[model samples]
Target: MKSTWIALLEAKYKNLKAPNYSFVLDEIGKNPYAKVVEDIRRGFSINEDTDENTDISFGYVLFLAPGRDFLLRISMIAPYAFLAKIKERGSTSQPIVRENTQDAMELDVLKILESHGISMFDEKSLKIGVPDSGKDSKSLYQWMFVDEEIPPWS
Candidate 1:
């Protein structure tokens, strides 16, 4: 699992190409997906929920890269103690805008994630409240990172 996570990030850094990109990883309790939904509804407050209340707690890591014309989003979730997610966006308005390829770049990034042994899920599992598919549904990358063991570097 550690190697897979590491490989995913290394691939993103090497295989992906974008001018505006960001990678983020964090440790979260189970139900992160649900928490995100709650945040969207409750003005995005972190103090409202208890860590112990986390049912499917885990860690998540993400990578986001944006270009002048497109955007990319990638993420990994683990039941252990790590988390990461990535997001990217592109502009389709005009050719004169700088850093406007976020959408295109996002697609490219997603492809990379898929090639790196990442998995995308159609719906949330019975144990976790994550949606199977929809607006906030888990992507293939998120599915790829279902394990929870942290790497040695961490």
Candidate 2:
């Protein structure tokens, strides 16, 4: 299954000529295949035009393993910028709602970008914060959003 998905992504990358792209893969709370799971998730991001001479686009893919086959979801985030925010809403409790804000930080994101030879200035470039749920183990899903300000020129 992982091979099929990787092949599909490679095919898409070859067929689509987008200036930017990103991918994310989730693999938490699932049994290990061969070795211990070093990372719970992975992701990638790409930006070709630094001068704004071309359309800015981005893509992301995620995988979730729920005791069976892994679940994968790929998304293309267009109109890319330097900073972005992702929010996760908590369920209703005690007449209060919890809102968590963050940016994309799946490790695979950087790997994918590097695979395409895309350069990033610093590791701090991607800023994402996951809320600390009451439970010891909690899965937090993030809704990605672009920042209002222009990305800093590097």
Candidate 3:
């Protein structure tokens, strides 16, 4: 069966026109885990605007682990715009401020998910980290949100 989340996301992207951009929805057989991966690779150009290259991708993994534990993992290629904005404030090494910013983003993502009928068993900030991207040692942020219990599917 298709997941409601995947269906919703697919619907959102149904009208996209970017070439080589697609969404991959997968589930672990007999396991309470599912993932939605989006890969976008395209170029943009306008009659009066500068051409631009786009290669952004991201994914969300929803896992219902043993003991009814629920977790959501998000990984993305940090956009240069976002990195620039953060750098304008201060070094990313500032734990407190960086954490707050990450928490805010996480909340926004969660709110969107929740609005679509997903639920959270607890209120807590997402755990975030900036790790080597493994491509060219670039850094990418990973966000992890945890819930004690999974809510009813909507």
User: Candidate 1 overall Cα lDDT vs. reference?
Assistant: 0.29
Task: Give TM per candidate.
Answer: 0.21, 0.21, 0.20
Clashes of 1: 51
By lDDT, the best candidate is: 1
lDDT string, candidate 3, 1-154, tens digits = 2243223323534422321223222111221222111110111110111111222222222222222212233211111111111122222222222334454544443444444443332222112112223322212221111111221120
> What would you estimate as the lDDT of candidate 2?
0.24
Candidate 1: tens digits of C-alpha lDDT, residues 1-154 = 4345434434533322221112222333233354343322332112222222222222222223222222111132332222122223321221111133345433443344344443332222212322344444332233333222221112
How many clashes show up per model? Answer: 51, 10, 0
Clashing pairs in 3: none
lDDT of 2 by residue, 1-154 (tens): 3344234334433422231222321111121111211232322222222211221222222232221111111122211112222223311111100122122342344344334433332213223222233322111111112221222221
lDDT of each: 0.29, 0.24, 0.24
Which window of ten consecutive residues has the lowest lDDT sum in model 2? 90-99
Cα RMSD of all models vs. native, in order, equals 17.0, 18.2, 17.8
